[model samples]
Structure formats: C-alpha cells, structure tokens
Target chain A: MAETTAPAMAPARPALDETLLAALAAAAGDESGGLTRRLAAQVRYEAAETPSRVRHLWRFTDPARLLPMNLTAVTGAPGDVSHTLAPSVAGAAATIDLWPGLPPVVALSDDLPAGQLTVVSAGETAGSPALAADELFAALNEAAWNTGIGLAVADGARLPGPIHVRVHASAAASLPRLRLVVGRNAEAMLVEQHLDGGPETRVTGHTAITVGDGSRVRHAIVQVWGQGTNGHLSVSTKAGADADVLTVFGVFGGDEAKLEVRTDLAGKGSRSEIVGVTLVTGKQHGDVHTTHRHLAEHTSSRIDFKAVAAEHARSTYTGLIRIEDQAHHCEAYQENRNLLLSDRARADAIPELEIHNQEVSCSHGATIAPVDPEQLFYLASRGLEHGEAVSLVVGGFLENTMAKLPDDVRTMAEAFVGPRLAAIREGSA
Target chain B: MSDALLNPANPANVFACRNLHVFVKDGDQEKEIVRGVDLTVQRGQKHALMGPNGSGKSTLAAALMGHPSYRVEGEIWLNGERVDALEPHERARRGMFLSFQYPVAVPGVTVANFLRASLAARRGTEIPVRAFRQELNEAFATMGIDPSFITRYLNDGFSGGEKKKLEILQMLLLKPAFSLLDETDSGLDIDALKVVSDGINQASGPDNGLLLVTHYQRILNHVQPDVVHVFMSGRLVRTGGMELVTALEERGYDWLTDEAAVAEGSRT
Candidate 1:
C-alpha cells in the first residue's frame, strides 16, 4: 500500500472585518453596479459569520458562486498599489516588478482601457513610462499596488522575447490584482506563473488581460503551489478585431484549488485557442470553469481540457461557449475529456453551447471513460503486467492532450503527470 | 497429476484436448455445441477442421483459446501444461495464437506498434526498436504487404484480403507454440488465397502445431493437410487421412450425415 499522507489543516476562518463588511452592505443597497453590486453585498453577508476554521473550503467545493465573491474580496484588500490606465504607450518600456514570485504582467500599447496607458514602478524602473488612472486609483484605494514585473511595447510594435511574470506568497499573505492591455497591431508573448513558498501558504490572485485590434498575444500560466495552500486563479481576456490569442493554462500543484478562465472574442475575425490539463489525486479538489464568448461576426474559438482523477479526489470541468446574435458566421468548439482510475474517484464535465446566432457553427462534446480492456489485453500480451500496461495506456492517453502544449511547458507538465500516475497506481493497490 | 499422460508416438504433439464439450446458454436453458470430442495436434502438424456452418468449428477454436463466451467440460493442454484456466491473452503469452475470421480493428494504434507490443508481452521483454523494425519488415515482406500498411491503424480500413495477410503477418511475428487459424480463407479470391496459404505454410514449421478451420475444400488444395476432421451436429464424427477431405468434397456433408442416421436406424 502507498504511504498515506495526512491532509494539511488550514488556519480557521478569521472574524469578519466589520468595517469592510459594512462597506459591502451599503454598496449592495446601491442601484448602480447591478450584478457587481449585488455580489458585493452577498460576500459581506457571508463574511458576517462568527470566526470559524473553514479557510475557504466552501470556495474549493463550490466555485460557481465563490469565485466572483473571492474576486471582490481580493480587490478589496487594504494596502499600497501601483500602475495606471492608458490608450497606448509606445516602445521599450521599463520593468515594473509589482510581485516577484508572480508571473510577469506585460501590457502592450493597445491593452489600455480607452485612456492614456501608464506604468508606475514600485521597484527600480527597467526603462518605461508610468501613468496612473482614476478608476485604478479608486480601486487601488490608498493601497499602493505592489509592483510586478511590467514591460510596454509601442503602437504597431512587435517584440520577440517572452515576458516572464512570477508571483509568490510571502510569510504574510497578500492579494494581488493585475490589469494588462495590448495595443492595436502590437504583438508579444507573455509567460506568467505563480510559485508559492513561505510559512503562510494561503494566497489569492486576480489577473485580467486585454488584446487590441490587429494584435496578437500568447499567454501561458503555470501554477505550482506548496502543500496546504489554497490557490484561486481568475483570468479574463478580451480580443479585438483581427486579433489572435492563444493560452496554454496549467494548474499542477495545490491542496484545494479553483481556477476560472473567461475569454471574449469581441471583434470580427478574432480568434482564441485555449488548452489545459490538470492532474488531481488524493483528497485534492481541482475545479476548472471556462466561459468563452463569441460576441462579434466571424469570430472563431476552440477549447480542449482534460483531467485525470484518482483516489478519493474529484475534478469538475464546466465549459461554456456562447455565440451572441451579432456573431454571425462564428465558429466555436469545446471538448472535455476525462479518465477515472478508481471507483472512489469522481469527475463531472459540463460542456455547454449557448448559440444566439443562427448562422453560427458551434459544437461541444464530453467523454468520460475508463481504460479499454482490449487495449490493456493487447499491451499485457506484449508481456507488460497489468499495472505497467495500465500505466502505458494512461500515459498515452494524456500524451494526446500534452502534445498540444508548447515544448517548454510540455517538459514541466510531464514531470507533474509522471508522479501523479504513480501515486494513483499506488493508491489503488 | 495422472502420470502426465505421455504420447510416445508424437513427442511434438504440444496440444491435446479430451472429451471436450461446450454449451451455449440461452435464458435458463443450455444447448451443448461440442459433444465429447477428443483432438490432438503434434508439433509441426498442419491440420484442417472442416465443418458446415453452426457445426461448432469456431466454438472449438474459441474454447481452446479460452474465449469467455463458451462454457466447456474438457481438459486442454498446451506444451503439456493445463491452459483451460488461463485468459485468452495469457494463453497467447504462453505461445498460443488465434487468427480470427474477422480481426478486430483497434484505432489509434499502428499495426507495427501492436505487433511489437504483442511480441514484447510474449517474450516478457522490450524488443529493441531496430530489431523490431527489421522483424516487422521481414514479416510484411513474407506476406507481400506494402510497408505503408505497417503505420496505419490495425485492421482499420483494410480490405478483407489485406486483413487476412496482416493476420498472417502477426502470426509469423508472434510465433506461438500452438495456433488456431479460424476461417482464414472465407473472403479471399483465388490468387489471394494462394498467397495467404503460402504465407501460412512458410510460418508453420516443425516446432508449431496449427488447427486451420475452414468450411470449403478450396483452401485445402493450396495447403494440403496430413489429417482432416469432419464436424457434424457439434461432434467430430470421423477423422481420416487427406482422402476424407476429397470424399466430402466429391459428395457433401449431407452424404455423411445421412449415412450416420441410416446406421443408427439399423442399430435400433
């Protein structure tokens, strides 16, 4: 039998911060923000409970409601903040290291939200312009944003090297928010990763990216957290006209995790391809939710996600591809495939397509299957014992999805997958 | 357990089955398909089992290979080792091979890769990449198969003749101690049949025993058998030399059945 590792216990929940709680209650009563306002109110009410030791276990199990709540809470954190709004910032910007262990946040000239793009360096400037926005100022409040690695490219500029961002949870936990924008005709590759190491392992993060017209961006996020850590990743992207975005998202390590990815193809000829794979075992609960919006005509999107569940572990995949009415001639496809290795393991895949445009082409497929006996027999007949045969088949199955990853990330993914399969085999035996 | 009953006449007789009876279960009733049949194949012996449809030829082959669908009341020995308790693939790893009438199509796995895996399992070791390729090429050449077919999905999109040839190729690579060729000549043309028969003859030698099951005497012409057994009503009624195949071809299965009924009537 495999050695049974004990589950790490997180510190009990903290008492409600009555001051923040009251602010949320008042904001909920206001009519302006609509859903955003209502959500703020709900989070306040939930936080009104007496101090308990839950530590967001509820969030781990139920991400549908908890993810947005966690976002509001993270954005509401009290502290120093840096960074600003922009219409377009040009050529050879400086490095703004907001959070060291966090992945780099590189914003192209087009990524600005309809205003002059700015960068305020909390750390030494590598060489770039800094501009701050009113909304960011208010959202950031008095908290000067802890600067993360930042780089800026000029309008119609195309840079070659991949910008690397790394986020780490220090001895004191902190919530960091990143807003990245790319400009029209600008192109760059962004590699963001979260690495946690400290006595205080519980940390949260929120990341939002915007891709502009005639621009292209490739984003890769790999999260490898320490044991007992609770990791929550919420990422949203907006693609512009004739723009292209490709994301290879990975979640390799965490005790309890919830990851949400939402992408909007907001303009014509916009395209996005997202591929992800997670290996979850033991009592770990890994939840992945993706919402893809094809909001304009001739937009194309494709998503493929796979997971392997074993032991008493559970994995849930919820994918939604929505094609709006104006998105005519849009093409969207989503597929979720999973392999279950034990009777105690559970996996749920909900692939949904909400198409409002009659001229659009959309399809979603999901499959949950155990190992094939004939394939197993064929391998076993080649003299592989049953376990070794199962290992080869499982590895081969996951390799199909892993092949979709880029070379650099593919090597790291194999390291994570290899041990997960071994642990699963040992657990079953 | 019982002095390991020795067959001194044929030391190469690697497989033997005694009083083999098999039944098909339907609802609550069981209908026997193989009735008290005894058969033996010495090593290097190319034997043919000729029978009409539904006369239990395939059932016997399946029973010997340990297919789960049939229930048997018998003893089967391979290399003087009891094998009725082993699974089909286990029987295979122990050097028993079956060329199905219709080979299963396994998608996403190439024919050459499948053969290498089977060979590895049979030998309990990994076959080196270079050596495996060389052997695969030799097998394909022996069976007159194009090299491109090795990279395609196993038996998928293959013509009937091509599937038969691939099956022979697998047999040659796996090289089982005892082989069951089940209806290998069912869907072949005259020319294809000769090529297939030649491949089978080249693969079968002094060390391996084969039970070639067929319904027609046409295949027998290309690959003459030392002994031919006739199946009737799920029973091996008569066993004789090559003359039995010729006689049955000149007459028919009904000729033999009618004679059996007459003899039974006279006895009563």
Candidate 2:
C-alpha cells in the first residue's frame, strides 16, 4: 500500500477588487452593455462561497492552487499578439486579436464572402446569455476577463478547415473568454490552444459554445503551459435539435491544471461525444471533470477519457452522466482508463451515473492499472527492444482517443506526447 | 562442455541445447521444473517432444527462449551462436521464435502495425508502407483471415482458432531460423489445425529447425515429425522415430513411466 500524508492547508483565495473590475469594464468598449454584465458577474463572484474539499468536483484538486498569488493583471502593448492562418482556411476564416485593456481588432481575409461569418468584439454581443456564475473560477473569469472574442457562423456555412485560436499568457495572472455560435445546418472545426506562460503564471479561462439545429461542430482545446504554470478552465456547450458535437481536450504541459466540461442535450435526437487525453510526467498534476445532462427525449452522449502518468506525476478523472425524467429512451456511456508507467506514478478515476427515467440506458466503467508484463513480453518476443515495446504499448493506449481528433490536432498531440514516452526507462516501475 | 557438443561435427546443426536446467521461483523457494536435458536439431529436421500434463514441456521451450521468469542454467545455441544470456527480443532478432500456447492480446495495437514493427525489427530497417501492406494482405489471404482483421487490435476479442492462426501468421512473417511451437494445436479446431499446420510447413525449409511441443498426437497427423522424444517427470526418457508417437497413442504413458522409473533406479 502507498503511504498516506495529511492534506496541506488550503491557501487563501484571491480577493476581487471593485476598482479593478470597473477599470476593466471601462477599457472594454460599449460601456452601457459591458459594464452591466461585468458588475453582475462581480456581484455573483463575491456572493458565492468557497467550495469545500468534500465536494467531488474539488476533491482531488484544491481550488486555492488555481488562484494567482498576485491580483494585478498584465495588459500587453499594441502589436504584442501574433496570429497564423492555415492555407486551407485562409479565405473562409477571419482572425480576431484580443488583449487586456484594449478593444479587440478584427481582420477579415480579402476573399471572405460577405455575410458568411461574423467576427467581432464580445462586448458588442451584450445581449447573449451570461456564463453560469455558480463556479468560482468561471465567475472570476466572467467578472475580470481581460481578453475576449465572439465568433458567429452564418447558416449552412461549411468551413474548409479548422480555425485556430492561440492564447498566450503574457503575465503572471490572465483571464481569457471565448464565445462561439454556430448557425443551423452549418459545420465548423475550432482549435483553441493555451501557450507561452511562465512557471508562476496562473490563467483562468471560460468558453461558451452554442450549436444550432442540425449542425455539426468539432472543438478541441489543447493546453501546453510551462512546467510550473497553473491553469483552470471551464467549457459549457448546448446543442439544438439533431445537432452533433465532438469535443477533444488534451493536456500535456503544466505543473497543476484542472478542466471542467459540461454538455447539455437540450434538443431531441441530439448527440454529444467528448474525448480527453492527458500525459503527465515528473511531478506534474492534472485533473479533469465532465458532466453530460440529457434534458430531451432520444438524446445520447458518450465520454471516453484516458490518461498516462509517469515518474511521480498524478492524474485524476471524474465523469458523470445524468438523465432527467423527461429524457426517455436516452443512451449514455462513460469510460475512463488510466495507465501508470512508474511505481511512483498515481491515477484516480471516478465514474458516476444518475438515471431518473427507467427508459434510459446508462453505463459507466473505470480502470486503473500499470502496464501488463505479458504484453511487453509478447512484443519483445516479436523482436522489438524493451524501450520500443513500451513505447508501442503507451502509444497504442492513447491512440484510440487521439484518433478521434482532427488531423492537425492529432499531429500536434503526438509531437507533445511522443518525446515524454520515449524518455521513460525500461522497468522503471 | 565437450568440444564436440559446443561445435557439432555437422555444420547443418541449426539448434542445440546442452544439459538445460530450468527453475522457477515459488515464494522464497526455487522449484526445479525442467531437469538437466540435452537435445539437438539439424537443418530440415522436425522434432516432437511428447509428454503428459505438468511434465514441464512448456517450461523447457520458454526457458530456451530466455523468458525472464525462469532461471535457466544451460547453453542454448541457435545457428551456432549461444543465446541463453541474451534477452528474449535479442534472441528473437537472432532468428529465434516461440509460438506461445496462450497468445496474449495487445489492445489498441492493430495486427498490421504489429506485423510491420516485427518485420522491421527483424530486418533492421523500416519496411515501406506499400510493400508491407501488400505482404500483409497476402499473408491474410493465406491464413484465411479476413482482410478486415488488419485494422482490428492484435488478438483482442479473438476466438481460440483465430488466435492460433495469428501465431502461425507471425511465424510466416518472422521466418526464424529455429521455431519452438509450444502447444500451438491445443485449442484449434480441425480446419484451423490444418491451416496452421500448412502455415508451419510453408515457413519450414532446408535451412531452419522445428521443435513441436504437445501432449496430444492429433497435430502430428498434419505435420509429421522426423524424430519423437517421450518426456516424463521433467526429463527426456526415450527418443526414437515416428513409432514412439503411435505407441504412446495406443498404450498411453503408464508403461513408459514404469520403464523410465526402473531405468532411473538402476542408473542411480
């Protein structure tokens, strides 16, 4: 049995100042609209109580670790943001540059067809529904987001390639927000990456995605922060009738990180699939939580999450599926598998299901174990070296989930996970 | 070790083992499973080691292949090179292969990918994708396996017959100089048995040696053996031609065990 240690006392939660909130609201244009939303979010953030460790969502990770030590925000100078456009989507997609304490600058490609897509500052879309304020970090992001963007795709627009959004943290504390609205019968792929933060940087992010009826959306969030950086992210998605949504979440770099995803099947015959892959080595830590709520009849959802832990790294996964009484004839499946590559590496998995209707079919399973020796021996007997055999096994373990990603995203994931798997020694466990 | 045993007079001697003893750890005690034994197989020669259950026939084959669980104290030579000290993969790279009685399943790894990697490791270079795919397709046709199995995980959720056929398929790909088939025919049906036997025959040639370990004589009907050795109580007691297999089938193993006991008593 592994040794047990007493839990460390939680750090103090960072305070939110009304003066700073007002300043941020003023800098974000559309004073009448943005200020009202910011003030409401600030009130919600202050009114909410700190979550206790007893809550399953906050059980493995301490919320205080996600809070930045300093409360000051850093605003980048003009022209500090860099952007890249893939050739395939060069004509169809537009780029939006967001910086703290400045209005967003939108650049439309010359070949972009009129009325096909709308790229604008989030402050202009003030009538859009506000993000849920029950969570601490999400409310913090809503109240003090320094960088924000809103993207709207016209109905029946099919993008040739994925739109890329790269968020670079320029300071110790940063808040980023993104809102996406897909029109009916449209198809779009979005890739959001978090990068360029230092060891002590702490980032809080919130993303809200709304899909229209009979539409398909593929969204991927790849987080590759510095070795000692801390990140907290929340993603909430809602699907219309017959809409299909696929979300891929990849975590490769960070000292401490947490991601929470919630998908609501609000339309009849809608479907949602969520795939997550996390690789942690050394003393890094990763925690992921997902919830699928079926609100309409004939809705379905599937969640598959896998994590590989090496050295002394630790990973935690908790997934829940809830079927309401009105959600008759719904199907939900959740699976979480963890691979431990070292004797010191650790993994924890919790799968939960709640069904209020007898007509629903729901199943969930979780497994945590080290690599099988028989598997290694079998590969070795086929002439592969020990290192090569181990690499093959680990790669295969992640391939099932990674294969579901977009082509470019899958390549990026391999670039991040391949080297870490190669560095592991034979029989290190 | 005598010079004659180390360097056999016949240059065609493809595989030879001298006084091989295998021990497995059970808790804190070392349990001897394979008593000291000597055997030799020349090129184009097929040998069958017949024994009853719990007689350690599988242990000898595994120990000869350098399985990490067994403590082997003996010399195993393949193609005139000693390999007992090498790792299993190293031995495999040097033309040694073992078809396990119970093949393990590797989830998330496709059969095509595994075969490509194995071929690459054996040849010391990556095989071209197109050529590899063509070869895999041909092998699949010969093994009577569906081409769809190429994309399926290796042996995962495979039936008993399918697993056995895959083992033979691997043999056809690796083309080891010496192949030790441990109970390859145990769970195979009649049709699967014939197909696997045909695959084994196709892989065997004038330059390689074959050693089949089994407790049943059914598989021998498909793949004939040139030499048959009766194993009892972890030792090879009698070695002869095909007559031994027929005798064991008609008379069973009790008579052989009685004679072997008397012979051991007199020698001691």
Candidate 3:
C-alpha cells in the first residue's frame, strides 16, 4: 500500500513570521543536521489549513480551541521540573529536557551503546521515518519542537524493564517529539509520562514508533497536567509482520485535552491492542480518537476505551477500524463504555468500521450511561453507603483499563483517579 | 394480642414489623404490594413464609430491608431500634440482611474486595488483611466454593447456584441479626439446594432470627422452620406450626387462597 500523506493542496493561511522561525531555529541549536527537516516542516505547517469543524476527526472538539494563543515561547530552567529514572536492564537510557525557546539538555547514562540510542535536535532517528508533517498539529510539533529522543533496539534485544520517559512542561507552550524503532525479534516497553504544568500552560507532543517483523512492544502514555492547562498529543505506530503492539493511554488531567492515536498493521499476522482510560471531572472536557488500519492478511486489532465524567464534565470517544481490500481473514473489535456520575455530566461515543474484504470479521460496540442503578442497589444492600457504592462502581468501571498499566504506573494512576471520584461524590452530595 | 408482642422493644423479639404497607408506582398509579403485615420473629426462631407466585413475598422482604424503589409505611424494628426511616445500607449496618432473588452483577469488583468493604462497613473499622483473608477462606471452604472465585468479579458471570452461594457467603460473613432470604431456593438443582440449605443452617444461630420466603417446600426438608405462614394476595392468612408446611405440600396453595377469599368476603 502506498503511504498516505496529508493533502498538499490546502488553502492559503498566514504563516508564522520569519522572526519567530528564526527565534525557534536559534533556540533549537540547529547544528545537529536537522535544520532542513525543520524548515520543510515549517513550510508544511504554513501551507496546511486548519481542520474543518465538519470533519469527523475534529467534530467533537473544536480545532480553534487547541490553537496556541497569544503565548510566546519561554526558556525553561532545569530547576523548574524534577525527574526520576529507574531502568530495569543495564542498557543505555537518556533524558531529554524540553523547555520552549531553549536548546534541549541531553544526558546519557554511563553505558551508552554507540549509535543505538541518540538524542537529536530534529528529523528521523535510527532509520525511522521522519515525522509525517501531514496534519496541522504534527507539522507544528515538527517545526517547533525543542527536544527529540530517538531509540533503536537491535534484533533479539529483549529489555525486560521498561524505558520510562517523563516530561514536565513549565513553559507557557511546550512541544516535545520522540522516534522509536524496534528491530526484528526484539521486545521493548516504553512509558512516556507528561506531568505537571501551570494553569495557563499549553502542550503539544508527537511520537512515532516503527516495529520490525516479529517484534513486540508495549507503550503507555500517561498525561496528568494541571486542572486549567490544555494538552494536545498524537502518537502513531506502524507494525511489521508478526509484530505485536500494546498501547495504553491514561488521560487524567488537563482542563481541555485532545488525544489521537493511530496504528497501521503493515505485515501478516501482526496484531495491536489499544486500551484507554480517561477521567474527567469538575467542568473538564476530554476528547480521544483512535484508528487501526489493517494493510495485511491475518492481522487483528482490538480497542477498549472507558471514560468517567462527573460534576458537569464531558468526555467523547471516537474509534475507527479499517481493513484494506487485500487484507483477508482479519478480525477487529472495538468497544467504548462511558459512565456518567451526575445528571449534568455527559459522554459521547462513536465507533466506526470500514472493511473492504469479505472474509474479515469486524464488530464495534459503544455505550454511554450513568452508573447502573441496579448495581448501586446491590452494593448498597451489601452495607455500602451511596457514596461508597458510587466510588466502587466508578472504580470498577475503569478497572479493566487500569489493569493494563504497569504496577508503578497503575499506582500513580489510581492515586490520580481516586481523588477525582471522591470529589465527584462530594459534589453530588 | 399480648402487650409484649405489640411492643416492638420486647427483648425476646429480634425483629418485628407492624402495619407494614408497601406501595410501588406502576406508571401513574400507586399499587399496594404488601398490605399491612404485622409480624414478630423471636430470637432463635426460624420462620418460613410460603406463598404462591406473585404473592408479594419478595416485595415484603425488600420493603423490610428499606429498598428505595418502594414506599413503605409502618414500623420496622430491629434489635430494639425503629429502622423504618433508614436507608438500605443504614438498615444493613443495624443488623438487617436480605438475600435478593436476582442479585445484580457488579463487574470488575472482585468478591474478595467487595466482601472486605462490606465487612469494614459492618464492623465500622477496616478488618485486618490477614484476618479477613483467613475468614474469607473459611467461608469459601464451608460453602464449597473454589478459592479462585475470590478473584472473580462479583456475580458478573456467575451461574444461578454461584449467585445464591455468594449471597449466603455474605450473610455468614456479615452475621446479620435478622435475615430475609427471598426465594433463595429458586433456580437450584438438588445438589445446590442441599449446599444452600446447609449454608442457611450454618448461618442461623440462637442469637439471630431467620425469615425464609420461598414458594417451594423442598428447602424446608433441610432447614426446619418453627413457624410456617401462608401468604396469599398481599397478606398472610394463616400462621401455624410444621403442619402448615405439610398440608401445603400435599394440597397446594389453592385451598388456602379459597379460605382467605372467604374470610375477606366475610370481612367486607
């Protein structure tokens, strides 16, 4: 299948002035052979039109709301954030600090495998394809990103411990990028966490991963921004023959957040599992979209996304599964369940499937409902108060998705979710 | 009636309800399901309220437990406290328990976690982890349940017998002062029946009272009832000893219904 690129024919729009581009270029310290790619990305961002509100991808969330407003880039100091590192295996791991309007500070561990893992200013890494520069946000991230980490795992290298990356954005507007490539028969786990931002902060992040034949990868992205921040993040993956990819998303914060994840199965016997848990409370709004495209035979994919909204908060989920004409004997299933905690809280779910092959099996289901009254009654009959019953039911609603997270990350997510549920109960009371 | 029987505060009685009327909304009309039931269960007594289908036995039991779907009128006293105005959980905390006819499934809640939370609420303190686990293991063994069921979701995909067993397990763990088992014998095979009957027998003691609301007399063969009452048309018409169960099993409830109808005709 031909690589689908963002449409080149876009309406003319006012581009960022040359002075801002110069400022970005100077801040990026473009001596690392990334100037040309950044320039091309800028051109694409300038040419691309804002997504139309009628487009299905942008229907639930207004694109204009995500556009970074009257905010200028500010240099971030290392003291502004704190980080911890605990790598499971004796492999090299790097930490890249991304503060807008400043060159990234890259620190590598003592045991660095030369050329296997490198931190670059921009462009592709480890023979991985460059950022698609297609969508408006992708192009913007590629053009303005201040930090990038590229990791390439050699064939047969199995890393039992996960490579954890944590980014805390203190700048008014922040952009961070990552590129990963897993070789044949390799096994790797990556956890990327976006944590801690000011009330007025805005974040835009992009990550691309390429899985070689017979590889297995587990990737989790957890975002816990401030209650008044805005976050937009996109992650895309392409899996080769017999490659298995499991992706988990935990969206717990941000006043208004939009997340998009896409997976392309380009080889036979490849499979993907996408799981997401989003908790919104106290007037927050969250929108998530996912797509799984099958381009090879005997490929399969499943998506399970759950959301809980409380206290006038709202959450939306849109998922799509597409099987190409030649992709035979493929199986795809998608399920979305939303639990509303208050009459004022709301949720929306949209699931779609496009199967071109007659031999494929595809199914999708979506439900948006308040906590089941019968379930509440049953729990109450067991001596649980109404508030306790609500919390238990809400916690159970997200348990399946939370179970997919690693132990430490699951603990962190529970700590974040527990209070939100309690707040909801208190608000209702 | 003796003054002691009318006084709900009598020490000998573990549970009592007076002039209890349960009404449920059916569209725009208020339909009475349990009409003015007055009964008292003494300590150490097992009472069986047998009735035909649609006799409002389940409604009466639910109303007694303070289910919110029904509007209950009258007095419900448990362990010397008037509990008619309390919520279901409040009533439960005051030593009232009801085993539902059709227990709802709570997905993703493991039986162990649910049981722990319930015990915590009942005891007003978190049970020690090791002690709770030991007690749970003992209960599982007594109920003949596989230990793996502790990790399974609470009644999510459980079969009929499993659900009933879980209800009984909860009763034994919580050790309520008064238990209302509404049709707990329905949808059980002979083997499940004996197991459930044994669980019921184990949960009953001299300190507590049991009200077994069932439509069949088969379970009576295992757990003997000191008092048997015939419920028909939203009220109990006859209260007697073991002879009532023996007579109903042979002649069915039609004869009792006819007698109750004649009595109602005379009253009107």
* DockQ for each numbered candidate: 0.22, 0.73, 0.76
Q: Which ten residues in a row are the worst by lDDT in model 2 chain B?
A: B1-10
When sorted by lDDT, best at the front, the candidate numbers are 2, 3, 1
| Candidate 2 structure quality by residue, lDDT tens digits, A267-345 | 8999999999999988989999999999999999999999999889999987889999999999999999999988999
lDDT of 3 at B160: 92
* lDDT tens digits, residue span A1-429, model 1: 122333433324322343443343232221223234334433543443321223222323532211111222222221122211110112322222234223334444333334234442222212211211112111221121222332344467666445545555432333444556778898866666555533335444555667888889887676666666665666677888999998887776666676767888987999999989877777777878787888889999999898877667788787888888888999999988887777887777877778886998888889887766666654543444566556656766666567787665666566567776675545453
Sorted on TM-score, best first, the list reads 3, 2, 1
Candidate 1 regions exceeding 4 Å error are: A1-60, A63-180, A191-203, A222-230, A250-252, A420-429, B1-11, B21-37, B50-63, B67-73, B87-89, B101-113, B148-164, B186-195, B216-219, B230-268
Give every collision pair in model 2: none
**Per-prediction fnat:** 0.24, 0.69, 0.66
DockQ class, candidate 2? medium
Q: Report the lDDT tens digits of candidate 3 across residue range A1-429.
A: 122334433333324645565566666554544656667777888777778655567666766566565434455565444332222223426555555565666666555455445443354633443323227888877777754566677777775456666666666677777777888998877778777777777777888898999999988888888767887898888899999999898888888888888999888999999989999888899999898999999999999999998878999887889999999999999999999988999888878788897999999999999988888878877789998899888888888788877675676577678777676546452
Candidate 2 chain A: 10-residue stretch with minimal lDDT: A83-92
Q: Candidate 2 at residue B92, lDDT?
A: 93
Q: Point out the worst 10-residue segment of candidate 1 chain B by lDDT.
A: B1-10
TM-score of chain A of each: 0.70, 0.90, 0.88
